[model samples]
Target: MKEIAIAGAGPMGLLLAIRLKQLGYENITLVDARAGTYTRPGILNASIFEELTQLIGLPVDFSDSYHLKDVERSLYKIAESLNIKIMKANFTGFEGKALRVEDEHHDIHILPCDLAIDATGSRRALVNEINRLFPDAFSVQPIADPSHKKHLMAYVKVEEKTDSDPPSTPAPYGFDFMVQKLEELRAMGWKGFVEPGFYALPLAKNKTCFYVEIPENLDASQHEKWLKTVVAFHTGKDNFDYTLLPASRKYGSKPRFLTFIVDPHQVNEAFFQHAQFPCVIPVGDAQIEPDYRIGIGIKSGAYRIKCLLDAMVLEKDQEFHIDFEKYQKELAAAMQMHAAALSKFYQEKQRSYEHYANLLSIYETVIASASMSKQKELQPSFAELIQAYAQSLYDAGNNALESILTSSGDIPLDKHGLIADEKKLEDAIARLIDAYKYAQGDLYTMASLKLNEIAHLYEKLADVFIQRGAYGSSLKCYEKANMIIEKILKDRAESVLIKYKHTQTLHKASRYEDMYDMACQTLSEIKNIGMDPEEKKKFTYKLELNKALALLHILHIRKDLEERDYYEDECNKAIKHVKSSPYLKDKHLLQLTKLLGEIPIESMCNILKDGDKSDLAADKSKRR
Candidate 1:
């Protein structure tokens, strides 16, 4: 049996052991430097539940322990359900495929294994040992923001409650409330607010965990006063009492210092100046130290374990060199994707907060006015509030567009002769006009601009076609525009803008069949595009008039009965295409509906009973 020794009894180490065991590697040992399990009041976020579930085949249940459940409880439940028994011991040192651990009696136990995983977390001792033993394999760097450390502190105690009392105490835990309180404190010359009412497990009946986070720079003397105020705010004086423990004092120290480093980037800079190992893998915080507030450390640790497992599985069959190269590439890709996602999330959040702040200011002003006797008869209604919110969104969109235009230098621009420069300038101007129109909910303006741009592009193509004396090809461009305008108006029946374009394009295209085809295709395309009833009516009139003329022309050309019958079949197919379209307006589509209705009832019933084979053949021809 393949034996693996994993250091650290934390979630990452435990999860790795469980996964390895499931993969048929059962002889495993989990070692922690501490003598026993370390207990501290820490919260876990719900994001890691999926990862936990995948590692161990179990669904997390949070209803048992905590009254106020969040992400943390979800994590704890998953961890508890793993079923893999944990053994506590101190990790003294390590040798090749062997580790030394001290038991309860202080007797050192040496165990041999196939592999030794350094899941000893962010300990400098383990890192230093690894670097010294394999100098060419490991690298270390200082964590950033080393000075801005603050400890996470929480208090837990049991209290007595009557049967009629609520299961969980009502408390405000949102960051907004904390920020507001902090601002209020800042007004009174205090650096930070005493954040209160953080929810936790109801350890016993009438007992609740009263949690508070204290920053490193808080005044020492004011700490007690702050705690008192927090306790009073969360639990009323009559209902519950408090017990502050000694362990809570340990959390009064500075928080962990974190560093954001890219290992491949370091390698490129030759920071691994004297590395010699076959594979020098850095996992968890050693790889990249993100902010603790984001709870990325746990996520990074779990991800690293999964990556290691993947590499190990691949290496079993593949050459060591190939496996190492593939692993490094995958690692780099994961890091880049993570960085991009994190950056985008924070950027969007900052923008959202700014928008919210502006809305709040406006609301405050309106409320103040309503409170005054000067505005006794005037008060903003619910609809007015909704309108204000929508306007804010529009304003934000406009601001975003303006920022892109002014600051984004990546957008191309030409600077040659006056005529060429003016054309490029016009294109840029048109783009900005479209953006502004979209922000202002001016759909007509957007449609008009798009059609105009398409026309100009097609006009240039037509000019090239004319120079080559390809009259048919030149006419196709005008025909294409005519079709587009027809569909636009058909769909947007009430739109004056689309009607004008449709009329103009239809006037330009000469061929009768081309005009008819354009109208048919336009009707089909309009099913996909947006349009109103009036726009639909205007376009429908244009389409039917063109179709009638085209059918008559085809009849005049094909004088023989058989040939005339073929042309009639083609016209019917075109009408069928418009009727069958998904976007066809039921009311406006009634033109084709009525035409089908006008056919003899017996013939219509026969056609419906025995589907048109000729129509099917025509569809197959179109596909080809």
Candidate 2:
């Protein structure tokens, strides 16, 4: 039997010990400073619960999440019962066969170890020591872009003042049961609170653990200022106490405030290869840092344990050889791929949140202004309809944003994987469109709401689609939004702006004819209208230039002598307008004009072919 020592008796270490024993590996020891008494709370999904229950031959009760202490205590009993030695000691470091350890009494000792596995989450004690002492044993690399701005998450105990005494027992876990309990509290006049990007996990008595996600750029050094700024910005209220819990822990009986910087980094394969000690390997968070924001750590840890067993360990009574090279290659590739994908996931989530914030702010402002303003009695029904529409808009927008944000990325898998939440973004878009159709109001308010609010919503949706590489979807959204803008147009400038925006989308979607028609129609519509000379000149220059380019694209697809003549004329018109505007630079303009004066059929085809290749490359890049 191999003398194996697993450090850190967390879920990963305990599970690994049980599996190795079942595989007929004896003389295995599990060590941790906490000695199975854990306090930090962690989320447990269905996958982890099922795995633990099957491994131990006992039901591991399911819950939305659990405190690390509860999971450790339960797993500790199974580990001990299986004849796995459990030690109340800390893994200090290792030197070949000599493993340095510190007992609970703080006395140092060295234990013989043929192999060592580090399951210590995030602290990465053993891995760090090996790299520091040996200098060439391993490497640390950021899974996500290190240059990305790090966010903050603060987990604090929130104590609410209640007239009733504290409960004798702990809180329940079932979802339906918790819902019923919350309803009962609300029925008895208990008014709870809500804040953006925050959630509450119930604890014993009237206290709950509020996981407050601090937005970027907030000064976390000043606790009060950060909390107040977050609340006021989200709720438009300065009554800090009423909105958010007190920043100080003095008010709570169970005072707990733990803050962590949300930065995801990982160790390279050299850390696992153990060039110094080939028998040494790291597991769980020590291998790849978990994205705790979406609760992927525990579940991923379970997956990693099973994968490690499958790849390295064999059935009972078989050759007890480990394929170290095979596992290292698998893990390294997974880490690199997961890191690249996770970076994009966070970027998309940040954008979605920003879009959500804008929509929420607009919705709240509209509702607030409508409530305070005195409108004609005849318009009361219309005002109510508009308010109802705003509420629907907020609901659908939240659903769309949450669908992507709640998704968890799979780090252990060879390929990138993401599990989305309940509703798809397409569903939310459908619901919003349905609500908009019924939002009837007086002319001015309706037009303002449609143009400024609804149209902008579609534009934001288009931006998201563009980010997702759904060019056709983005083009449709932009075209529909431009139609909304046209319906509510109040001036010649508005007409010109709508056409410019629509033609831009058409150009991106490669609808050259539609782009040409839009520019032509807008030029005709604004021909007789009075406008500022400078503004008109700028719009005219862009519209004619785009119109000329659209015609060039059409001529590339097929020879068109008449259209080619029209294209040259349009280019001259663009030059004339651009020259009139002293603000417009003609440095690059001269180069573009020089190219457009050509009449070669072969050149246009080559340019068109190159454009197509670039667009395909862009599509591939966006998908990544």
Candidate 3:
């Protein structure tokens, strides 16, 4: 058996020991400064609990009243099921092949172990000591707050059966439960624990817990007053009822707040850099600081324990210290990925909150306007209401887009990632368009303009489609591109490049009539806009060539000789313009001249072979 000692009995530390035992690593000792196991439940998000379950090879039974219950109750159940005893008394420090701990007598007791692990939970004193003792090996920060200090939670246990099923009010149960409990407490004039920066949670029957926190350097008295007001609102009176627990007092102090926010896999980095640590390896909280939101701490701790176990079982000949460094890079990568995700979640929440506040204000105004008019007919129509909502939605989308454009640093942009988020933006735009189609207000025109802007965004989407070889979808995107181009032309008709591209897009889409009309418009626009003689001649030549092609097609389709002659005359005039142009000095111009030459030759050959030169000559002479 490989003897390993783990320090700290917090959730992460305890879980580490449990996972080690489960992996068949016997002779494991878990140490903490606390005399007994952790009794109160820690603040862990539900997602973290689910992650913990997967790491430890045990199902987390969160059906109980508390989501993150005391590790004593939860871990004990796991211990019984696995037949493992993973906990022990305090761990003072470590030496090679041994660890020291103190009993009640203040004497040090040394125990031999092959490996020592520091899983101490945010204990700055121990971290600093390690840094000092192994100057080059440890990276310790005394004032790090990985999770922002603004979060303060209160866990309260409401009195059971007091008002279990109060009247069936119109308020939602989830929203009103806390209010109802507060009312009951206020009626009782309960003077419970009142502390600054505190919130309450009801963990069990007739039991409540309060947690308080604040940002560093904040005035405690102001927070105290706020806490009193919150308690009064809850109790419906000016007091709280409950005894203050010692644990609450300990938590009330400004916490040292340290965060490892570094890459978790970099655990061995300090060791390599400093060449310290004779036998003990820091794991879990003692190893690195990870984002608290995603519960990476517990997962990383479990992973570290598993790594140690694997090394012991598979690399018995190699030293344990050397083996520990091998897994540090992997841990660092996992830590970085989790931290980045947590940062993104934080930013998104900030944006969503601002948007929600704006929407709430608009909704209030609509409600107020409806109330002011005595006549129900004076109220805004349903279409008007939807239009307002859709506009707000579009504005929120614009804010999100702005966020994306201005976002700094690296962000994930692969498929099913940030790109999927952009797709959601497209869906938002489509919904806005649908809203405009049904809206009766004058604002629909404004909405249409917004849709034009959205269509422009399709340029980015089109690039994505082209890369994926969805040519059919690419074609539809090009049509939308043309629609935007047309709108721009209507607004800025003098823009030559815009007009030119508009015609090109039409031709690409195979809209012959629209393309022909654009060519004629360009011809008139060049002369009317007062272009130089050379520029005008260039435009006239291209327009005449386009007209000649259009007329040739018309001639092929016409059955009547009179209509054919008319188209033939149009072609003749167009060919004359091309022949008289000074720009026909290049190979491309030579090619055009050659192709146009074939047209008259083919017509003449038909007339001569049929012995109808007199008729053809009469037709040509009439045109002349």
Taken over the whole model, the C-alpha lDDT of each candidate is 0.46, 0.58, 0.50
Candidate 3 per-residue lDDT, tens place, 1-624, comes to 256666666666667667766655566666554524344444555565666677776776664453444434576567556655443556666554566776556767676676566767555334445666767455553223222344434444443345442111222222223333433433333222111223355545565545443344435445444444445444444444543333445445422221112222224343322223335566666666554444566666566555555554423533233454555655556555545655665454333323433433544454455445422432333233445455555555555555544244111155543343556555555554544554445656665666565555555455555567554444555555545544433334233433454454454455555656766766666665554667557656766666555554445444464766555665677665765667644453444333333345355233132224444455556657
What tens digits encode model 2's per-residue C-alpha lDDT throughout 1-624?
257888888888988898888777787888887766655544444466676787667765533455655677777777877889888899887766757889979998777776788888778878887778768566766777532333333443333354432222223333333333333323332222112244445545444554444434444465444543443333333332332334444334322454556677676653344445536678877877766555666666666666677666653654355766676666666666556666766654443333433433443444445434422321443344344455455456545544544234111111222223323544544444444454444433543443445456556666666677667877776776676666555354655765677787788888988988988887776776578877787777777767766766666665745656656556456545554646555453443433343433433323333444354445456657
lDDT of 3 at 411: 19
lDDT of 1 by residue, 550-608 (tens): 55454544456466556666565545544554555545344333334333222222332
lDDT of 3: 0.50
**Candidate numbers sorted by lDDT from highest down:** 2, 3, 1
Task: Work out the TM-score per prediction.
Answer: 0.41, 0.49, 0.50
Better of 1 and 3 by TM-score: 3
The stretch of ten residues in a row with the least summed lDDT in candidate 3 is 165-174
| C-alpha root-mean-square deviation, each candidate | 18.6, 16.8, 11.7
Query: In angstroms, how far off is 566's CA in candidate 3?
Result: 14
lDDT of 2 at 617: 49
Can you tell me which runs of candidate 1 are displaced by over 4 Å? 1-3, 33-38, 45-54, 58-63, 66-87, 92-114, 132-151, 156-213, 219-221, 227-300, 314-322, 336-624
Sort the candidates on TM-score, descending order: 3, 2, 1
